[model samples]
Target chain A: MLIWNRAKILYIKKINWHLCLIFAAISSQPILTSMTWKQVFSSSIGRKLTMGLTGIFLITFLIVHMGINACMWAAVYFKDDHGEMFNKAANFMGSMVVIRIIEFGLFFFIFLHIIQGYMLTVYNRSKRAVGYAVDYGSKGSKWYSRSMGLLGTLILLFLIIHWLHFWIPSRFTGVEEVEYNGVKMHNMFALMQTTFQQLWVVILYVLGCISLGYHLAHGFQSAFKTIGVHNKRYQTMLTGLGYAFAIVVPFVFAMMPITMYLGWVK
Target chain B: MEHYNMSLHLKVWRQNNSRDKGHFENYKVDGISSEMSFLEMFDVLNERLITEGKEPIAFDHDCREGICGMCSMYINGKPHGPWKSNTVCQLHMRAYKDGDTIVVEPWRANAFPVIKDLMVDRSAFDRIVQAGGYISVNTGNAVDGNSLPIEKDKADASFAAAMCIGCGACVAACKNSSAMLFLSAKVAHLALLPQGEPERKKRVVSMVAQMDKEGFGACTNTGACEATCPKDISLSNIARLNQEYLIASLTADK
Candidate 1:
């Protein structure tokens, strides 16, 4: 194939010099294409490894995300605190140049995970084209583990709405600005208060959080397993830790919208 | 145990070859003894088909006692049927009662293509094994068993992994048709032993690479394969494979 392409390119060189260069560029590369480092990471197991690594990174990001959002409960500690602490923490996260740069990396990883997740789901589904005539649902495995793709898609949908509510306003168009202790920044607190007023939005966010919980239920230990944490002791610990994280993280996140919607938080 | 006979209706997958578009063909067998193995019931049906001047349903089977992994059947939406840790040849008709409708099919995977009715070509498994073939031993006479001491847990784990018959049931039962369980079983079988030390890294890397080359799907860790495995191959082996491959690939000179 390489020789044939070279011969054709040589023949074309006599007729159209630019065409010959284009043909050579396109055809020659594949003819000599050998296994390289890039191909290594794109293989079946490698693709999963990519998912696992990126998933753990995203998991870490959620900690920061929830911790900062957890700042909304500052009213519990201080007198007449109206999301001031949450707003300041949110501002600190937003205005820092270091975080601003890392924001790109964060979104990049998120996008990579979403795209690769869908790709993996599609590829895996194709592995068994013709399914069994008799349905044996969830007898062999948990439904959530099999439905990661569905749960992930739900999370992605929620993200778009959540981002539209918060990310775009704060980053692109700018949020309603306010001064805390005479230091002026965006009143992301006010934005959250107003965003949760709609009952449908609150319901949707809760559903999103539920989906995220399930996604993490399978994904937390799955990421560990893929990265090679298979020992019985560590596995047992991780399984417990994974379930707790899955439940607590999403439950807290969901509560943010629920509390605001019900006027439980000021 | 008092024995009884039953009538059964079977919806079996039929295909001429890899290129042939397959469909389900139904067959009925009456007076099937409760003690007869599942394949023997098939034999009864095939004998009737012969008398009727119809083509006999072809399948793969050897050593009807279930030691040989040759028997491959997706009986009623599961590899090797309802019984846990049992192959098709060992599955008794006693599990069924009168007028039961049984659906049977070949292992559904791109890697395991249909050769005929209820039979798939599992050469892909052989290739994956061959990819991890041959541990290096200083060619010599047998040494003392105690020469290389191994822990009991490790030996038991390795023995469990070595019990894999390469039946392709894991692939059949897996939603993704992944060969991870089988591949992991092989990896764990060798990596736990002293004989497999020299080529440990090489074996895992090459076998996994070959598994990908065979067009199998990625492991999603659903535990379906472990559940369906006739040898009861554990999912821990898969986790171990993930560990092995991850470390090996990272440190690989390539």
Candidate 2:
């Protein structure tokens, strides 16, 4: 054990792992070291890996949030006193500890996702600064795929507004409502109905959902491919799945707002 | 492949450099064999031109076997000619018939500076690779390959990446002149293995830095690289590269 310790000390002393750690830490930091454009757009997997993981996580969050929102639909459709249910659910969730935890998680996920995405876009743009002389004619490719960064920025903006308007009030505002059966409900239906009724809000939500759909169309299959699921058996099916998710999620989510506007869901 | 006669008109692009304007020069060749490989047919044309005491048309080629990946030229507006799994040299005259007016030109990209005629300097790619493309394995280490039991699927995936010849055909084929396919191959090769984990973040960051310096375009996910590749490298590789880069940029040591 003594000899091993000595060897380890020698190894550390020789290679200076601490220095490497510092360098790596500095390089990895978003503020300290921004990636060059080549690094961002250099590899197929690199690009997809970034886009895919963030997309999966973001989409997962969206689905969960949408599911929660869909509870309002349940209340509206079932003809129950869902106002009470909403109050109970919101009060239970509004507990100090739970709200804090949820807030931290949301912040961490969104911040990391956006920071990475921004760096990648910057790298991509910078790398292609010089123009090509000859036209190789690889055009007629999909449009949405190329415009991910722009679409992502739009989504980010939506996320910021969403969190500011909804998440913040629900969490840090210290507001109270009701609790039932160990669940908190915050008159969310009323909040949503009133908020979503505004013309600009509805328009923005529609646009955001569309952008999310477009983002998912490329991002879904891209994630599958990133996780190394690229056999003939899965490729076509996976691609089909991407299209389905991209189209279905937005369509379903958008339906709620449209229905709300059309008075279909009360 | 059996020899057959083919009479074709060749419209080849001639350019001195980025500063010079380029145009097409046409040549008529008769009694060609469809069985002859595309490069071999060029050889025949060059021979005819040499005998006629004219400057032979210039093009690029290194390994005729398609392994070295040095040859890259757009034939009739298609990168690496019309074959699915072929390089410019591996392309056969059989892809065309008699009297076909084939147009040939070098890949156009500001990143890929031209040397002369159909030969463009692709050393920009070399710089990208040198800038943290490899796994940073020290020489004389003599590590056993099996010492690290990589998953079979991962091994196969790495093998696919290892097949990239750095031909720049992917960039040439891209409308955006994107090197996403090329960079993706390198990233996929390293990212699939455990040995590559140690330097993964640095590798991605540096390689991308080098790629940007080289002036390659962003990937639009058009997948032209897969279409034009002589080795049939996948666009999925590009996706993989993007994911790795994102992860690295997001959650690096910091």
Candidate 3:
């Protein structure tokens, strides 16, 4: 009788564990999916608060990503090494377990962001499908806000190619080697330079960066509002921050190729 | 200063009532003032119509100033008559000259039902507002603005959102016809204030439900609202609304 009771208890425990795991996974969906519109934009302040926070988070991610990629520009400029420094930098980035963990985090953030965006767009579409009587509104809304889905899709496509070319093959797949400066190096720098030198690759990079800029221009201020930071006194400052982020990060990213194309580096 | 006495053509929409079948009526207006407001030019045409023993075309207008948001018209492929940041009533005729053909139409949205020629019933916005758009400030709990001592920045943001005049321009300009901008303004205003704290989650829940119930289109972040809004309300408001919706949903206690 005692043995039978123990076996039953064990079975219940295993079942409970499986159920907990399933629930945990389900609970992590973007919180807005189940919310009412009132909850989404209940008040002007609430609306601004939410948007501001999300925008800032997205902008931060872009800046970090751009900074890491700037190493390519550095590699081109440092000619005597002829790719030695870049190769080391690439290897260092690949070898860092910390960077890998961050990369995973970035992947998660981006995936959730796109999913939430899609859901909002879908819900907005359904609601508008009913009947809208407002004769004149939205005359001042910017194009970036209007075409987020299209731009987001384009960025997503860029991300996929970006991963395949730089992340997936370079890190997950085996590293390729090339000889330079009488020394064999993990051809990561060579790969980067060659990729940038190609017209198509440069064009794609430029397009992606521009899209990122457009996204950030509105996104930064929106994120601040999301966290309840909307106020008149800081409005100009917040907008300035957005512009600064949008312009600087994309400009730096673009300069990498522009510089390379100009033959500023060997 | 460009001067040209423009003989212009117009295909204006005319309807007697919501149940009436609306049709296009053509008219020509000559010697229009280059500096005249778009509505003023319309007044000139209406005077001629009245003189001709015809009932002048009925339209809706409240504050000629852009603040009231009552004047709304779709001009030849653009909302609020082509000039950015100018409401239909504020749009100057100088924008067009020398025999330009214009098509004038009422703001078209599911929520807005046409009541007369170029006059739409935007009461759906009122319905959405009544559905929990206001802050649940308890009676006699008058809190001084300085009592909470909110950060100046938050206060400024709240003021900006509070500037929304409930105009339906965003819907007319939007391809999806989303009211996200309007909804965002309402949401952002209260969310920034401390008095709006206790029932924040419930407020958003009810208001958003009401907006959806009214048949307003979803916000796709196209920003046509910001471009055409006489107030130039920012698209950041919509993004903030999305974040609030997410947080409220996640943090709500069942």
TM-score evaluated only on chain B, model 1: 0.97
Sorted by DockQ (best first), the order is: 1, 2, 3
- Cα deviation at A240, candidate 3, in Å, is 2.6
Ranking by TM-score: 1, 3, 2
Candidate 3 Cα errors over 4 Å, as ranges: A1-58, A73-80, A115-145, A171-173, A178-185, A257-266, B1-7, B14-24, B30-58, B62-70, B76-100, B115-117, B133-165, B174-176, B184-201, B217-253
| True lDDT of residue B84, candidate 2 | 78
Candidate ranking under lDDT, highest first, comes to: 1, 2, 3
Per-residue lDDT of B87-181 in model 1, one digit per residue for the tens?
99999999999999999989888999889888898978866765664464444588989998999999999999999999999998888889999
* Candidate 1, CAPRI quality class derived from DockQ: acceptable
Show where candidate 1 strays beyond 4 Å. Answer: A1-36, B138-141
lDDT of 3 by residue, A1-266 (tens): 34334433543574553333223223322222254446445433333333444455666776666666566666555656665666766666667899778767766767767876666566555544323233333444566866676777888888898888777767567567977557555777656667677888878878988998887776765555556443445756987987898899888988777767666655
Q: DockQ score for model 3, please?
A: 0.14
Pairwise DockQ winner, candidates 1 and 2: 1
Candidate 3, B127-162: lDDT as tens digits: 455444655333455667676788998898889888
Please state the error at residue B4 of candidate 2 in Å: 9.0
Report model 3's chain A TM-score: 0.71
| Top lDDT model | 1
In candidate 1, list every pair of residues with a backbone clash: none
Best by DockQ: 1
- Candidate 2 Cα errors over 4 Å, as ranges: A1-53, A81-119, A125-143, A153-207, A221-244, B1-13, B18-57, B63-65, B75-78, B93-105, B108-111, B124-161, B174-224, B234-254
- Binned by DockQ into CAPRI classes (incorrect, acceptable, medium, high), candidate 2 is incorrect
The residue-by-residue lDDT of candidate 1 on A1-266, one tens digit each, is 58436745564455753344344434422221134566557777778888898999999999999999999989656768888899889989988999999999999999999999999999888887777887556869999999999999999989998889999988798888898778999998889889999999999999999999999999999998888888999999998999999999999999999998988788
